[model samples]
Target: MAPAIMLAADAPKLSSANTGFMLICSALVMLMTPGLAFFYGGMVRVKSTLNMLMMSFISLGIVTILWVLYGFSMAFGTDHGSIVGWTSDFVGFGGIGKEDLWPGYTIPVFVFAVFQLMFAIITPALISGALADRVKFSAWSLFLILWVTVVYFPVAHWVWGTGGWAFDLGVIDFAGGTAVHINAGAAALGVILVIGKRVGFKRDPMRPHSLPLVMLGAGLLWFGWFGFNAGSWLGNDDGVGPLMFVNTQIATAAAMLAWLVYEKIRHGAFTTLGAASGAVAGLVAITPSGGAVSPLGAIAVGVIAGVLCAMAVGLKYKFGFDDSLDVVGVHMVGGIAGSLLIGFFASGKGQSDVEGLFYGGGLDQFWKQCAGVFAVLGYSLVASAVLAFLLDKTIGMRVPEDEEVSGIDQAQHAETAYDFSGTGGGLVGSAAPALAAESKKVDA
Candidate 1:
């Protein structure tokens, strides 16, 4: 009886309301992965649409199993040297009990772990956008397995773990601007450089197959992101959660408008793709700084990130690295912009006493923000490149040139995203290419 009583005393207090709220937030964050699938699925050509969706969907399966195994331990376990974490009990979550609560927070430890699991599942999925239509599904799966183990787990530790260097250094990331966005963006750039460009390069337009689908996906992402950013604070313990919620909506709206304005000025037309991408840019930007800044600051971050990501997307064309879906441009650039901007916009009245450049604070917070952003970006870039390179040399990364030109869906997954048989008997799966061949035969 005394032992049980001692165990009870050791456990932190659990707030039922906060726990329920966090569970809902976890569910909302989980929705983002599927939301991402729809977003990427709608962006790719019809032939590879299923493959694109699978890239994001597969993470849900793979990362969940990993998180339960040792992923959580490696991330949030007791810190070791500030680079990694370890706790024997967290190995299989066998040591943890339902009664256990995350220290200082009112929720159960399992709730925190599962909530974070949603994040781990999506980070690697974010990189799939850059490698779309080229990579072998098996290779992509293997990359996720390795990446979350090496890149994501450690980075999560560094950015948020109790004893992490970045956490200790006063580098604030309210959600995951540096850990998730910048890390995924930099990794995407590195992989593209290693894997090289898609087959078409600059010749083909490679326009999105379905703008409506893209719009749908973007809408879902925007909806789910509120939980992603706001839930990071755990609860309204100090009212930051509500503030984050408002800032998220404000920033996203500002970004979408800013992106449209930039598009109208530069391209002479407002496109649906621009609207979706712009909203995501806003979400990414505010994810790091929303809790620290005001709604006005959020608008500033959103507008700057929107315009900058809009312009940055064109850099792929100029630099000659094919980031197929502008992952580096929007996510990496937006993440950097948001993280750094926190240094200028942070209000002492919010999350902490920290102030940005515009506030009473000077360059102190800016440099700290820089350290967190660059550290995650650099490590992820080098590590992801190495992993991609090794896989390319082994079981292989990119599909065969012939298979790629034909479409990776049939080759990788044995099924296409859609059937075109209804369209003038368009040869079932390979509609466009097959029809072209038939037209050539008729000409001959």
Candidate 2:
């Protein structure tokens, strides 16, 4: 115990600069939840817009409380057989000190914990997009609690926690390709399976009510993603941080272009929705491989993810699942493409020491990447499905069809997104003059 204490002391002293940087990154990451709210809200119909926003916003409230209680400890605490960490180490942050430095890092443990908490908050929120306008808000909220507890915490440990199985096996998830995006994506697929299709999934003309809102949300996500990708290094002064920053920009641009090209060839129009979705695809793809691949590799990953995800969005129509916002397609497919492509494109000269096939490495690293990807995918799928099934049987998971069609925002939240009733004295009082003038002009 004395030697252990001494080694802990001898580890790198906490740096004020790194701590401040991490705190800023945490703020940036926290903003992403609200950004996600706007993104999903705009994609939904006007009737369901508030519900969509609430779904993502609620995660910020619920997950933050859980993380403070035990989520952080479960994910990042002392290892327990590489499957999970012992929650007793930091439950309620018990025994952690203000000056306590994270193991082998220059930041305070509390700052690191908060940074991780932001990641945990946004992850489950990512799944909300798939269930829009159909699920009971109460059931969805409860699902958030159980899913994070059972699926997210354990998977986070398996990938990013010290002494985690995948970490020990040298899996190169620089950010959260497998853990966050893939985990959330697979979970999205699983829950949608249990909940079944929306009332008008194929029959109704359910288009976005507000593209400007969608663009705003997407822009915010793009800005906040800089911290998401580069801040994984825990410091900005490193060469890898700059590389990730540049790669993120390059990949996102390439993906948006690729998606636009695909849209023009396939649909004859380059829509704003396609551009935004493509950017998100690139962001998801580069998240895991940013620290491992070069700029050119990032472009390769982005273009592939763009084309594949664009094609994948149509699959729900073919296979008959109601992923309302294409979360499974853009996130899950992009994450898989990024994680697996690392086996082919990782440059040893980057942040990680391992090389990929294109960098003169062999199939060994590729296989390891595959193993990590499948492990998370399988676990998230099973765990999320079971949880959704139990909830559906017991407390009920979806709203009644009438409530869904009439509007989930009013049914679930008792409020609508827009009060058009207030528009110029109930329309007649304000529009009477314009209508009369148009009638006069027609008579003339």
Candidate 3:
């Protein structure tokens, strides 16, 4: 034990090939932020497109500061009596160097910290879409900072930290089926519930403003996913790394096809929006199982997620919940499906050693996966709901009706995405006229 401890102390000094690969993977994951900006930017109305992009753009600044200050320590520092970290050994990445922190892994501790930080940055950005078109920019920014602190930090500690209960429970989230996707998805629903819907949610067309932007975002997200999935290994020497890379590609293609086909059948035409959305759905679903399932299993997961998410999007209208951009459907429902189904399809040549029930590994793993899903879903829902309620009462979650009708771009940001008729669409720099118009319309 003494020798092992000594070796651990020296781990941060040893580095070579594996460290290089991990750094590249981290860069790739970081690129997903800009990609997501485009993906979401194209989905909002033309009048508010730039505002949509800004929502995502701000995360790079806000979350990065929070991550270095306390996010990393809270997420990865040694457990402090079962709730959070006790020590700040790596605050500001003080002790991180070019060495292995774990047995056989050679990347520096900073590499791991920054890679995970990229994930934290993107998760809150994902929720911004649910509140688009109606939120005050400053208020929304404050809400995210607080929300990540109260919600994201604890959940990350619970699932991925050294002494996290979920980690000890043997939950096999290779990437972020639970920590990243499901957590954000549930929180998205909570914030949307508290914030209320856009002024004309059910009545307006609310079509995406730019198909090209949507496709560009989808393409970048797909490319960056190679890093997101393969980087989970923290090494490039083994077969597992390449295997995950191949599976990520196959799964996304399958999902894209499934979504386009679904759209063609139901809406009479294949759409660029459907393809982009479907690809993202596939990526989110495979993130957990990419390193644990066979190639064929990936295809299965991608197809199912695509079809299910497509159907689930209609839930906003059917149930009158107003999820806005279908974050709950694509991320929440899709994350659950992917995380849960790996119990049956994790098999075949060059596959995960722990086979699923279909390969006669018994029903144990399937049950374990279900347990993980429930834990993530339950905690995220309750915690997020409580947080939203508290923030709503304390600081206000939604903009006033007048502000909503005039567009948050003007009322909240002092800027307009377009100046169609000068006066910034006839409402800029003037709040009273817009308020009067809004009052006259009532349910506007």
Candidate 4:
């Protein structure tokens, strides 16, 4: 790609390079759901693994359909009172044409729509980790439908949409600190409250069955996050895109190190789980701030997120709320840190003209960041709590105690994650005959 492809002021049009880059970024972001599946799956007990995987996988199907039909319109259509977009503007993607470009950008409107669709798909999936093992699959599916409509769409409009309340307020969510991570993290806490703790809770060991799977999932998430953070720029030609990409890497590395160091000092050992969680915390922190911060700033954000998220994970045990996979800890805390830190770390030389406090800009940007974080956090918590309570009172939110103990994978899906019974294997059958003859001889 060219270092910079400047478009003429009078005759702006689509660029093939930007379109292809965004399409690839969309695909990369889509992969994160399955990556989340493996990540969450490996963290649960053996019996609940399939259910864990399914929770993340289900969003890919549900959200894609919803996005194409109406979610996109509600999020990015004509502005409506600075709160949401007009559903009539792009319902069914009705008014957009093949030749149309995204308002001021060089990519097709469809490319931007699809890119945003990937974001919609993963936000609900992020909550599944908190509701793992005991949730009814049907209820979870229904919740996905409801949550995206009531929570994700409106908040997305508030942050990313044109003329959005936060956008107009200059909240500066470079990616989705407010719209995605904080939104999902707060929702996770709400649902966990309504669902109650797992059957085992504090007593059960509940060790991860597969660390390898967790590592693999973490790797995929780290890889895909490049597209997630960088692609938010909506074009490759801007200098900010590369800066965001490098910042993402730097921050993740720093966060991982910070988490490992904290683990070594606090827990007596550096752990694979800590490394993975740390990396995720870093990624979450940089999502909203990467484009605006330098490498050094990214490192500061990453180290802070890693250490804080590491401590935050223990809050579930202390507070008596069971966030199954630490979504509240890593995503919410990290997102809040990243977003708020932008007030102090944002550089005027970067994408936005706003300079943060560290560069002598004072507390103006910091306060705006705080406002955005609290708005999304408060809205998501209330909305998600109400939805979860309603679902629990109506069709029910959790499985029966018997199902919970017996394994939800079988109860919900009627299939286990692993079946060890051999297909009358040739080696086993041959060994069985020899063993029987030896037993007969011994008896004689």
Best by lDDT: 1
RMSD of each predicted structure: 5.5, 6.9, 6.2, 6.8
Question: Please, what are the lDDT tens digits per residue for candidate 1 over residues 1-444?
Answer: 999999889766889989999999999999999999999999988878989999999999999999999999999999999999988899889999998989888899999999999999999999999999899999999999999999999999999998999999999999999999999999999899999999988998798999999999998899899889989999877898999999999999999999999999999999999999999999999999999999999999999999999999999999999999899999999999999999999998778889999998999999999999999999999999999999999999999999999988878776766757655422345565777898899999
> Which residue window of length 10 is worst by lDDT in model 4?
422-431
Give the TM-score comparing model 4 with the true structure, all chains together. 0.93
- Tell me the whole-model lDDT of each prediction, alpha carbons only: 0.93, 0.91, 0.80, 0.91
List, residue by residue over 81-157, the lDDT tens digit for candidate 2: 99998768598888799998887789988999999999999999999999998999999999999999999999999
> Positional deviation of 423 in candidate 3, in angstroms?
10
Output the better candidate (1/2) by lDDT. Answer: 1
* Number of colliding residue pairs in each model: 0, 0, 1, 0
TM-score-wise, the better of 2 and 3 is 2
Error of 4 at 114 (Å): 0.4
Candidate 2 CA-lDDT value: 0.91
**Over 4 Å off in model 2, which ranges?**
1-10, 423-444
Full-model lDDT, candidate 3: 0.80
